[model samples]
Target: MSVIAVNDGTFVSELEGKGVTLVEFGAVWCPPCKVLLPILETLSEEYAEGLRVLKVDCDESPVTASRYGIMSMPTVIVFKNGEPLEKLVGLRPKSAYTNVLGKINAEAARL
Candidate 1:
């Protein structure tokens, strides 16, 4: 699946009933956020079956951002069953993300 744009209104529901979700809290004006977009898009497609990737503009979705305690731009939070599982701040290597997803998948399988 392609990257999904999420707002305050759709945040909660989007996370609900999902297996695993990676939410990027960022703003368009932020350079690092811009740099991270394409990486997330590619991951979204590569992990299509096991993960769901969503983006939330911090400037446009303040409520969702605050709820997630996003003090910095480009904070990526991974969620499972609507609960946050892991959080990564700033720009990270693609392998870093895949590593987290791998752990989540393993945990899910064990459960």
Candidate 2:
């Protein structure tokens, strides 16, 4: 499944649901952000059962971006139980994300 695109008005509500969420704060003009899109898409499908991947156009959702302290484009914030769990800036290998997901899953299992 494709990553859901969210604006400031819909951002919080989208993340209000249960489970893990990876939200990318980026803009259309960012090159690295464009490159990260496919990676996120693949992840959204691979973790469809346990994860929700979302994208926020920084230009369009400045409020939500600032709320999360997004200082740069292509910042990915991982949320657990509707709270910020981790933040990964810039583009990263798929394994980087999988590693975090693994940890989240392990923690979830422990709980």
Candidate 3:
């Protein structure tokens, strides 16, 4: 699947279902956020079966950003069943994000 752009109005609904969601809260002005976009796009397609990728521009969606206590751009949050499970602030290696997904996959397997 492709990364979906979300905002304050659509954020809750987009995350309101079963499965895993990775949401990146960022802004077009942030250099690192720009750097991370394609990485997320790649992951979205690779994990298309079970993961959904979303992007929220902080500048355009302050309500969503503030609700999550996002102090910086590129705050990536992993959610399961509409609840936040983990958050990574700033730019991180793709492996760091993959490790998170691996853990989630493990949880699903155990269930």
Identify the candidate with maximal TM-score: 3
Model 1 regions more than 4 Å off: none
Candidate closer to the true structure by lDDT (higher is better), 2 or 3: 3
Q: TM-scores for all candidates? A: 0.96, 0.96, 0.97
Against the true structure, whose lDDT is highest?
A: 3
C-alpha lDDT of candidate 1 relative to the true structure = 0.91
lDDT of each: 0.91, 0.91, 0.94
Cα RMSD for candidates in order: 0.8, 0.8, 0.7
Give the number of colliding residue pairs in candidate 1.
0
Task: For candidate 3, write residues 2-69 as lDDT tens digits.
Answer: 88999999999999985899999999999999999999999998898799999999999999999999
Candidate 2: segments with Cα more than 4 A from true spot? none
**Better structure of 1 and 3 per lDDT:** 3
Model 3 — which ten-residue stretch has the worst lDDT?
10-19
Encode model 1's per-residue lDDT on 83-103: one tens digit a residue.
999999998888899999999
